[model samples]
Target: MKTVFSPLHAGHSGNVELIAGAIVPAFEKPSRAEFIRARVESEKLGPILPPEIHDLAAARKVHASDYIDFLPTVWPLWEASGRSGSAIPFTWPTRGLRGDVRPNGIDALLGFYSFDGGATFVKGTWDAIKSSYDVALTAAALVKAGEPSAFALCRPPGHHAGAAFMGGYCFINNAAVAAQWFRDHGAGRVSILDVDYHHGNGTQEIFYRRGDVQVLNLHGDPMTEYPFFLGHADERGEGDGEGFNDNYPMPFGTGWDAWNASLEDACTRLSAYAPDVVVVSLGVDTFEKDPISQFKLKTGDYPRIGRRIARLGLPTLFVMEGGYAVEEIGINAVGVLTGFEDR
Candidate 1:
């Protein structure tokens, strides 16, 4: 598998995030990608290439233009508002509040565009955000050009971002963008399998009303996890997408036995769908040591996950997502790739 990466991800590092009612150092740091890249190198997984430049129009296909415009200007607007720290949202328009109105104040706009305060905007955030998008697209392009599989080492992981809102340390939904790029180019059907510990609420929402792309996710149940709103078994797609979206909401202490069972079921469904390509939102946070996630997957189990996906025998794209056990992230994430290659 050829891996696409970017050093620009180092630019979006934030100092703090509010977790468990207390501020702490951001877990989604640049080192996460570095470790994964280092492992890919040490393992001789494949060639590591820089991302190709893609037009902003490609991103607009999956994200709203207004949201895209708002992201790049966040830091400048925050600094202009006399803020000294990283730009974070404190208030959100919820329940009965008007969601359609766009506020002019930087503080209000931040909340308007974000679901939570986790995705901070630093001086280099925009550059990193765009680079991450480029990385995903470049890897997707490789698969489109006939490569069987590729890894997009995206940072500021994108599973939580939606078309109009940003959260969960994600700005643009890289996996969603790549899936859309595939459809727009030539693919008849594309399926996204998000294996992140957290539910891929963004990817599901992006494709919930469409039938061309199928979205399946396995994650911590929403009742007891971060992004604790969606990701239930009942969130079947609407309209043309009905019965196309699937979510396996595993409980907190889920082990590899239960998790792999869910993967087997999802792969069976993918076989039925027979998409032209598959996009795996590869997140190893399910590892037992992951700080913010719950699950009991071990390092040795990752390769099995890869081998199972490989059994499908379809072109695949592995886009990096969350995995905060920075020390072991590489072994677990790359284990999936190596397992697939071995298959």
Candidate 2:
């Protein structure tokens, strides 16, 4: 598998996020990508290439244009407001509040564009965000060009972002952008399988009203997990997408055997969907040692997940998502790729 990566991911480093009722350093740092890159080279899994530059045309397909316009303005607005450290939002308009109105104040605008404070920004954040988007597009292009599979090593992981709001350390939804790219280019049908520990609320929301792109996520149940809304068994799509969307929400202590059963069911549905291409939102946070997540998957189990996906016999694109256990991230994430190659 050829891997797409970028040095600009380093620019997204050193930001803080609001979690657990306190603000602290972000766990989604640049080192996570570096470790995975190193393993890809050490394992001699195909070439690692820099991404081709891309515009927001592909991203605009799934994300709102106003939300895309808000990201680049964050740092400038922060500096004008005389703020110093990472730009984090502290408030939100919930329930009966008027979210329709866009505010002029920097703090208010931040709250308006974001669901939570996790998608914090620093001066170099926009540059990093663009680079991650480029990485995803370039990798999708490879699969579209006839490669069996490719890896997009995206940072500031994107599963938590939605059409108009950013959260969960994600800015642009890379996997969603890539899935849309496939659909726009030439694909008759596309499917996204998000294996991230957290539910891919953003991806599901983007495709929930459309039947063309099938979105499936297997993650921690929303009742006890981060991004604690949606991701239930009953969220089956609304209109043309009614029976297309699927969610496998497992409890806190889920391990390999139980998780594999869910994957088996998802793959069976994926085969039935018969998409022209598959996009895997590969996140290793399900590993037992992952700090921010609560699944018990061991290093050896990742390959099994890959092998099962490989059995579906379709072109695949792996877009990196979450995995805060920096030390073991490479082994687990690459294990999936190697497992697929072995199959």
TM-score of predicted structure 1: 0.99
Instruction: List model 1 lDDT by residue over 1-343, tens digit each.
Output: 8999999999987657767887777888999999999999999998999998887998898889999999989989989998876888888999999888998899999899999878888899999999999999999999999999999999978989999999999999999999999999999999999999999999999999999999999999999998899999999899999989999999999999999999999999999999999999999999999999899999999999999999999999999999999999999999999999983
- Assess each prediction's global lDDT (C-alpha) against the native: 0.93, 0.94
Residue 343, model 1: lDDT of 36
TM-score versus the correct structure, for each prediction: 0.99, 0.99
Q: CA shift at 63, candidate 1, in angstroms?
A: 1.1
The most accurate candidate by lDDT is 2
In model 1, which regions exceed 4 Å deviation? none
Candidate 2, 219-302: lDDT as tens digits: 999999988998999998989999999999999999999999999999999999999999999998999999999999999999
Weakest 10 consecutive residues, lDDT, candidate 1?
14-23
